[model samples]
Target: MSETAARAGWVEITCEGELREVVGGPNRHAAHKTRTALHALDRAWLAHSPLCFIATSDGDGSCDVSPKGDPPGFVKVLDDTTLAIPDRPGNKRVDGFTNILRNPRVGLAFLLPGRGDTLRVNGRARIVRQAPFLDGMTVRGHRPALALVVEVEEVFHHCAKAFLRSGTWDPDTWAPQALPSRARIAKALDRPDDTLEFLEEYYGPGYAERLYG
Candidate 1:
């Protein structure tokens, strides 16, 4: 079948009536949104979550979502309205920091493994590369070189329907997976010398020891 004919059943909801027809009304819990700071429950969730996905947009409207992971409480809750995340050592892509520099607005989704509910925070953020704050986020005696300081504008707990439907926390649903071999990727992109095996050999057994900056 032609592509257009194959997609004929798809309806575009460009008008208000067509949009409302699918969802059928405003959210029932719209009034539950909390603005200005983290509530007690929000604080607890942040304390226990070891990972979160941060979303940011450039001034031109291009966007990126990046994962931040460390030990639980790696994201410090400075106060009801403030929090900080240490920027640990990595390949130095700086996509997230660069985006924050262009546009400070960001959204974070905190996830705890085996826990269905997730915490969401949206706010303004700034990249901080100072001694005192960076030193405070030290892991295994190695301090982070930079930090992302966030001014919490809103915090809320999201229901677990999505996770439940996907069986994210169910062990039986998980299958063994492996990282895509960087060697193949490099060859496909026209560079065969830079490979996964080369990187692993270069990093050596002490690679974990050098993770922190």
Candidate 2:
């Protein structure tokens, strides 16, 4: 490459002397102050999803990625711009919840297992300990650790490309064996007691009871 082109900040060299393109991606869509996208969680979408990704970040830039899952429809759609969900019992790290306290920004992506498409929601959130929905929710005859109230900003239909490329829904490409054993994963997480055996012993019954009832 010419010295003139190399002098531009768009190119750089790594410690291994590998030349790299620093930044050359087309710009994304402009942010709309008032979103025209769908702002509601449809019952069908929430009813079919088995997992959701939650992203939250503190004011200081400390971020947390959390995975939420259950039978289905744990998230309740209140209206076109609102949703609620009871936070079930767990390890109690509360990283996502705490981040919401100091920062209102929150993002959610819901995926239906074996389905290519997903739902995405961006919004501000707050911890809601007492809500009408929480009134009847009980796990093992105990109330949820907490409930989350999300005020929707924008909701969009996420394409299936990521899932297709990752073979997320393809049973033939599934690698249940490649995953670490439950006990080993818990050990690496510094919670040897967090065995699947233990979680199953506790959550399995509670999840079924609360979900069905």
Candidate 3:
């Protein structure tokens, strides 16, 4: 549809008051659940989370979200108000790191497989090139060259309503073949010059062996 036709009948919310009027206010617990420091429960949650999504925005307001994962407890809890996430092998885009250089503010969502609830953290972050704590973050004999350290500003546990509604953890609802395979998609969108056989071999079982290499 044309821009004007697509926007037709759309009512924009201009202020917090107007938005709140439509969604209503939170209850006392929801309003007061945010904490400036990590509680024991929060620390425990971080210990068991193997994956997290980090959100960052550059000075120009360009945003990026990157997933960081490893064995459970890969994220280190330095203190009640600090956390350190080790950098791992990846595509080398470093979009999130580039954004952090321009803006230190970041938001993180930690999740555990098969669990619906998640832990949310918002804070100012800094890239640490080297630290004594980095020694303890080693995994599979590979130590990270850098880590992202965050100073806690807000911490809270998010409800599982969204996950439950989508049946995210229910194996019965999974449809892995619903879309084209990764190799096919990559060939069509990113690696058109490569053969499908080569792409499939590149993404096959051996792919997991290169995680820390």
Per-residue accuracy of model 3 over 1-213 as CA lDDT, tens digit each = 999998999999999999999999999999999999999999999999999999999999999999999999999999999999999989889999999999999999999999999999999999999899999999989999999999999999999999999999999999999999999999999999999999999999999998999
Rank all candidate structures by their lDDT, best first, as comma-separated numbers.
3, 1, 2
TM-score of 3: 0.97
Q: Which lDDT value does model 2 have at 183?
A: 52
Worst 10 residues of 2 by lDDT: 30-39
Q: What is the lDDT of residue 105 in candidate 1?
A: 99
TM-score, model 2 to reference? 0.71
lDDT of 2 by residue, 154-202 (tens): 7777668888899877889878879876556666676756767775555
Q: Among these predicted structures, which one has the highest lDDT?
A: 3
**Which residue pairs in model 2 clash with each other?**
none
For candidate 1, the TM-score is 0.85
**Is 2 or 3 the stronger prediction by lDDT?**
3
- Which segments of model 1 are wrong by more than 4 Å? 1-9, 15-17, 178-191, 199-209
Order of candidates by TM-score, top first?
3, 1, 2
